[model samples]
Every structure is written in C-alpha cells, then in structure tokens.
Target: MTATGTTLVIGATGTTGSRTAARLMAGGHRVKAASRRATSIPGAEPVLFDWYDPATHAAALDGVDRVYLIPPVGESDPAVVMLPFLHRARTAGVQRAVLLSSSAIPEGGPAVGTVHQALPDLFQQWAVLRPSWFMQNFTDTHAHALSIREDGIIWTATDSGRVGFVDAEDIAAVAVHALTDEHAPNTDLVLTGPEALSYDDVATILTEVTGRPVVHRKLSYEQLRDRLTALVPVEFAAILAGLDRAIAEGAEDRLTDTVQRLIGRPARTLRALCEREMR
Candidate 1:
C-alpha cells in the first residue's frame, strides 16, 4: 500500500473488518469501507459491496490498490464467488490482498481454504489470516450469548478441547499493518491468544462475570446435529457440528505468538475479553 493508494475492506460492517477500517484511517491511510448496505464508517470512505452480487464488484474495486477480503458467512463454499472476484480485482489493478481465513480450515482444504490456495497467484502481494476461534463469537454475536442467557447451558461436542481464542481487535490491528506496511508479509499466519482454554473454562469465566449459572454441557454429535438442523440446513448443520468434533480431536488447541510478533503486544486473554464484554 502506498501513501495515496486506497484500501478496500470487503466486510466493513463485521467485527474484525470494521476495526481494521478504523485502524487504517487512524494511520492516515486511505480506506474504503465496503458492505452490502453501503454503511458509512467514521474516518473512512464508504462503498456498496456484496459477495453474492458480482455487479457491485467493479465499483467497489475502482481506484483500489489493497483489499481486505472476507468470505461470506454460512456459505460452506466460497471459492465459486472468490475466484472471479480475484480475477476482476487483478484487472482493476489491485496490488495486494489480505484475506481473512480460518485456523480450523487448512490451506488447500475445504471451505475458504480452497480460496487461500488460489489467492497467491492472483495478486502481486497477498497474506492469509488463519486465526483461531474469535472471542467475539461469544460476546458480540447473538447466537452464543442467547444460548448462555436463555438456556443456562452452552452445548457443543467438544468435551475438553482447548482453544486460544483471538480477539477481533488484535486481528484487525494485524490486518491494518499488513495492508499499509511497505512490504506485505505474503505468508499464512496462524493467530491465537496468549492462553488456550476449553469451553468449560469459558463457561466458568462467563459464570463469574455474569453472576449467572452457565454450564458447558457436552452434547453428542447427533444431538448437536439435530439442534443445528432446526436453525440451518442439515448439511450446514453437519458442517458446524463437524467443527466441534474436530476441536474435540485437538484440532485448534494451541497458542501462537503471531499476534505479538505482528502487532507488538500479546494477544488479548480470554478472561479479559469475557470481563470486558460479559460483565
């Protein structure tokens, strides 16, 4: 990114993307906040963008050199939409791209990981952010919070798997650095918090913060599948449950120093995150 080049954030309304947009503006960099609604963000430019709608792609990419790419939510597959968008962004003269990927999804595997495999060759400079479970999944999102508030029990198949949940703010800070730095990192970063904790640990923290009884109850895969099917399609529900099973197998149970390495501070602790949001 140059001093005068534009930085486009694809999911500007989302938790991490919004923070990334704000950080870019604070650094005196040009930013374009793009979302489906064209919502304006403070200290940045606004533009309409939608992953499902290809027609809005060009206008959003107009005069943009750097991009923060976010895969659309709840769509198990994203390569179909991302591939074309990458080609179009190259044509529109995008020089770098910072993709928000997942820790659970391996590079060149399922979901957005497939998109990660193809991004390097499409742009001049690119970086992939593969952060572990987001801390916002509990506090900022309605689904997890509602479950804790209404049910008094958090249900998942992960019995004792630990996760180093990374704060969205930390993720955003790294993104800002990647987008505006003289040279892009051009590597796949696996980010995590300073400490790893299980869901039971999270429940204990919630119970302490909220002064309410919240229990982490392990559910069988079939039970979780049935519960999710009521809210989403069966296949999608299976995918969600499969993630829990993966976690149970110790898939995302490690801590990483990428956050501190990139942003000069240790990743936010889960206890701090819970106290800030749940309390």
Candidate 2:
C-alpha cells in the first residue's frame, strides 16, 4: 500500500513470507520482518516474533499498520496462538491482514481455517490465500526433497490425483499484491499454477529435466501416516497424510486463474521449477 505505513510480515523467513517482504521492500514499502530467530533479511527490519510467546508480539507490532501471516508450522491447530496475537495486532493499529492458508482447508475447515473465518471481525481489510500444494516441497529441504535426493523417489498417498502445484514465488507475488494493493480482497483467494499435475507427472518431468531417475512411489493413507509420524508429531502426521488422501480423491484436481488475475501473468509450471531447482 503506497499510502500505508509499515507492514509486519509474520514468518518473514518462511516460504511465501520472505518473498512477500522482499517484494514490498523492493517496491519502496516499509517492512518489519518477523521471525523466531529474528534473522536478518536484506531491505527489511528484523524482529523477534513467535506465536507461542506473547512478550515478543508488542515490539513486532510497533509502527505497523498491516500484516502478512504465515501460521506456525507442524501444528495441526494454529488458531489458538494465532487468534490471540491477531487480536492484539488489531488493537495495535493493524488495519489490514493477509493470511497464508492451504487449498485443502476452507474458512472454518481446520487449522488456519479458524483464523480465516475470524479475519472479518478482527481487521476491516483482510484476505486469505488458500494456495494449492507448493512446488518447493519437491525441491527444498522437505521430506520429498530428501527422499528424492537419497532414494530417487517421490512418495505420496495421492494415486492418480492431479494438483495445481503452485510456485512459492508466485504465491508470494499474489501475497504482495494483496498486501500493497489499494483494496484488500476481503475474501479467500485459491491460487494455483497454470496447470494441474500429478506426482507421477512431476517425477517424469524431474527425470526429463534433471536426467535423474526419479519416480513416484504411491503409498496408502495409513502407510504414509505411519511413515510421517517418525518425521513430525503424530497428530500433524495424520493431518498431512489425510491431505494426501484427499488429493487421491480428486480434491486438489483443478486449476485457477487467481495468480493471473491478480498478478497479470501465467503461473509457473512444475517443469520450470524442476529445471531451476534440480538442474
């Protein structure tokens, strides 16, 4: 927002948050980059912020009029901590808030969904980003990335289900637009890439681009859940596994023009991501 004051970017070092903060700063906007370690980001004011800690909230909220929210990771339910800080944020003069949510979760569905539902009551200018699964999951230090590096395999419970795997950078562009635009969407925006693709299709593209032997190894819901329990909390593991199951049921099999409509550009493709990250 050109006329607005500083915008506090919660989870500033995280996936979409970091990119959003950078874009804002590049556009000559003030930003308070909120993170757990208060990591330094170029063109941003770093601030120590944690959802579990209330003492860190006040300092981060100082002199900020808007916020970009990235909910706590690995917690099946984040609304408990998020809602309180949001309430405090409203009192501290935050007029607009942009939330990062998932396509699988709707307003009042689960997890950040609760926060999505409460936005109207808290901030007059508020928008929720419900993006499809991120393409970075297959490239970054995520479990899929690690497995791809070690075993040359991509594991998932979604069998034959297609998803509009969006790029985090694209998601951030939409986020920046939502945060800085004159009018907040005041609604949930379901973002996706240009096309829908399945895990098998992803592996095929990876192999073609990177010249690596990557394959999609499909698993049952219970199997994936048990496997993920060793990596994350049991409850979160179940939730992640359940999302994969939903994908199998064609829940994520679609595409949207939100990215194009908001940013005036076609969403990036998984093949492009594979070429950049893998090759």
Candidate 3:
C-alpha cells in the first residue's frame, strides 16, 4: 500500500540506509533518519538511535508506521537487540518492515539470519533484502579500497571465484518498492548485478577505469582470518574469512533477476560504478 505515516530508517548514514532514506524523501515520503549522532539529512527528520541503548528505541518509534532495519554492524547475534526493537515497533503500529541482510545468510542461518527468521512473525507486511557483496567495497569504506589507493593491492581469501557484486543503489531501489508499493512483497529478495566477476576481473576493470595499477592478492582462509582478527573479534573474523572461502568455492558465482523485476531497471555493474566514482 502507499505509505501514510513516517518511516523510521535505522543506520540512516550507512551504505544502503542513506540511499534508501534519500529515495524516500525524493518520493515525498516522510522519514525519521535515525542515527546515533542524530545527523542531519537533506529532507528527513533526524533522530538519535543506538542499538545498544534501549532508551533510544521508544522515541524513534514515535509516529513511525514503517521501518527499514539495518542490524548492528559486526554483531554476530543481533537478534538480542533487534528482536526487542521489532516487538516494540509492532506494538507502536509499524505495519511494514524491511530488513537488510546478506545473500549468504539465509533466514535461519548465522549472524543477522536470526533477525531475518523472526521478522515475518513480527510484521505481516515484511521483506528481507539479501544482496550480494557490494560493488562499493572496492571504491569506498572497505579496507580493500584503502589498500588499492595506498598499496595498489586488494587482499582476499576468495581466489578466482566470481560474484555478482551489486551496487548499493540497486538494493535500495528494491527496498523502496518493498516498503511503499501497493502491496507488500512478503518474500526474501536475492539481489545481484547482471553478471559475475572474479576479483582478478575487478582489478582489470579498476586499472582500465581509473588508470591505476590494482592487483588482487589472495590469502589462505586461516591467514586471512588471522589478519582480520587484528581488526575485529576472532569469531567475527572467522565468519568474514569463511565467507571469502565460501566465495572461492563458487558460492557467490551466480546472478539474480530481482533488481530488474522490482526496480524495472538492470542492476548497476562494478565497472560502471567505478567509472562514475573515479571521474
């Protein structure tokens, strides 16, 4: 249904959240841009929200009829905090809920999967966005981007395997349809770009688009996990490293038509994104 009340966007400044919120505002949809610092957004109300703090939950829920959930980053068990907030939102009259989840994590798998499993029961009008690895990982915030800029290298355990690295914008577009369409799509969407490419292919594209030398450096799963442990918890590190290994085993070597079907446009490719960002 066409949305009537304000939609609460958690992690409003994050990769997909910011884009989703901006799209909502562009469509004249009311939005509460919820972030820890209550950061100002162009056309949405700012509200302070912290997953670890229950006090921020109630006020953020005020007058919110819809919610876009982005679980606490790096937390393996987000259901502990997520479930409680979802229950509160249900009581506060949130009719639709859209959750951002990973393509690798199924409804009942590990990590945010716990929250994915509980979302359907909490809101009858709900959808889970399971997008593949983001194309921005090479152009933005990720360590690989920093490495490419500084050392001309990209490290990963995923050797030679291809993935349909999708753009964050495509994920957000699908999310908007799920959130405000005439009828809620009560299903999980596996979003991906038009084709799969290996990191070697990515390095080639980067070199061509940016005129910079970029190389893919493959590491063993254990080595990558140990390297990541220096930056994140060992358990979470293992999970991240394991994902790379899974990719290497061809787990992510696939494409999906969800973006085209929902957004009515082909998903953006990594090369296209790189060319735009580099310019």
Candidate 4:
C-alpha cells in the first residue's frame, strides 16, 4: 500500500532539504528524511537512500507517494543516477515530484536538465525550483568560513555581475508549499532574492557585519579552478569555475520575483541574510 501522507525528502540532511523537511514537519506533514546514511535530523524519521546503491532505493521509495528529489552532488551526470529513481517512484505510484535544480544551468543544460526532460513523462505533477547562488556560501559552509577565518577574502569569477543571492531557507519554504499544495505551478520556477548584488557588495557587507576587513578578490576562471583544487577535486573545481564564468558573462545577473510569487512575500535580501548569518 502507498504511504498516504508521508513525503520522501531526498538529501534531507542538506542545506535546502533539511529546511524543507523542518517546514513540512511544522505544517504537520509526515516526512521521511532520505539520505545515504540513516542519519537523524529534527522533525523527521531517517531512511537510508543512496544514489549510488539501487539496493537502498526501494526501501526509501516504499510507501511514499510524493518525493523531493535532490540531484547527486559533484556528479558530472546526475540525471543518469536519478532517472532510475524517478522510474522507481513512478512504479511505486508516486504522484508528485519537486526537483531541486540549478539556476546557472538552463532547463536542458548538462546537469539536472536530463531530469527536466524525463520527469514530465514519468510523474503526474512536478515543479522545478531554480534558485540563484545561495548567500549561505559565505556563512554556513566550510569553504566560505575557512576563507573568512584564514584569508579574510572571498574569491570568485563573478567579475562585476550581480546575483540576487537567494536564501536557502526561502527556497525551502517555496518547496514546502509546492510539495504540499495540489495547485502548485506546474512549471520551472526561477527563484532569486529581491536585490541584485556583486561579490564586492557581499564582501563589503560581510566586513561591515563582522567588524573586519573582508575583500572580494576577482580571479580568472582558471585561477579560481586551480585555487579550489587545493580544497576539492580538480574536476569539480573546473565545473564550479565554469559556472562562475557563466555568471561573469552575465548569466545570473538578473533578478526574478519567483520567490515572492510562490511564497507571497519578498525574497530575503543579501544584507539581511548576512545580518542573521554572520557572527
């Protein structure tokens, strides 16, 4: 028998997925936090669901009627890994899917674009949330924090282009509304913060907030990739730098009202995000 009320939240321990699960739980919805390990988080039961292992797939899909699909991280071809899971979800009689996709990549780009192509035929209802670069890059994650503590510098290939730097919390809120409501807009939604700001703007804000000197160092794509290789794999670093090049070329410079449209409120501003996030 299909699980009537539970929503399977893939990558539920991640930045966006964790927030999505919490919001779902707060709304009194049953949530299964699906991850590679049976790790526990607040507001949800843990379930083992690895993208690499199909053996763990069925148990995760079992009884769940809806899913929040997070693409495998650092994979060159995430769609290859996720398509089978989507097929399984369809076979399991899952009704709706909310896909967490990238704003940098277009609908048919190299990343989750394949899922964008396949999901329409597989699921009865779907919504894709394409959000701009997260403001949390400077606050929560290891790399950004390490940058702050050690060098007091932020580096990127964004050049002078401004991003609307949406908050992950806002993205999660939209995902919760999309997954729970039957009337969710059945199309790709590009979500961004209310104002557009450059890396310089971000660094200035961080400096002001933390009472320290924080600088934005503009690096060439190649230089950025080389530097990131010291922290992450060279291949992943290349991909990230390429996306930053896309930003530098003005791909992610525009702002959208998707967050406000979906959540009925203005998206969080970068300064506001920093005020709360920076310590």
Q: How well is each residue in 39-58 modelled by candidate 4, as lDDT tens digits?
A: 89877889998999999999
Return whichever of 1 and 3 wins on TM-score.
Answer: 3
> Model 4, 198: alpha-carbon shift in Å?
0.6
Instruction: List, residue by residue over 182-204, the lDDT tens digit for candidate 1.
Output: 88888889989898889999999
* Model 3 lDDT per residue over 130-220, tens place: 9999998888878888899999999999999999999999988888888899788999999999999999999999999989899999999
Clashing residue pairs in candidate 3 (N, C-alpha, C atoms within 3 angstroms): 1-182
- Residue-level error in angstroms, candidate 4, position 258: 1.1
Q: Estimate, for each residue in 1-279, the C-alpha lDDT of model 2 and write its tens digit.
A: 455689999999887888899888988999999999999998899999989999999999999999999999998889899999999999999999999999999999988899899999999999999999999998988899899889999999999999999999999999989888999999999999998999999898888988878999999999999999999999999999999999999999989999999998899999888888788
The Cα RMSD of model 4 versus the native structure comes to 2.3
| TM-score, candidate number 1 | 0.96
- Alpha-carbon shift of residue 253 in model 4 (angstroms): 0.8
Candidate 1 off by > 4 Å: 1-4
> Weakest 10 consecutive residues, lDDT, candidate 3?
1-10
- Can you give the lDDT of residue 16 in candidate 3? 95
Candidate closer to the true structure by lDDT (higher is better), 1 or 3: 3
Q: Give the TM-score of candidate 4.
A: 0.95
Range of the 10 consecutive residues with the lowest summed lDDT in candidate 4 = 1-10
What is residue 30's positional error in candidate 1, in angstroms? 1.4
Candidate 3, position 269, lDDT: 83
TM-score of each: 0.96, 0.98, 0.98, 0.95
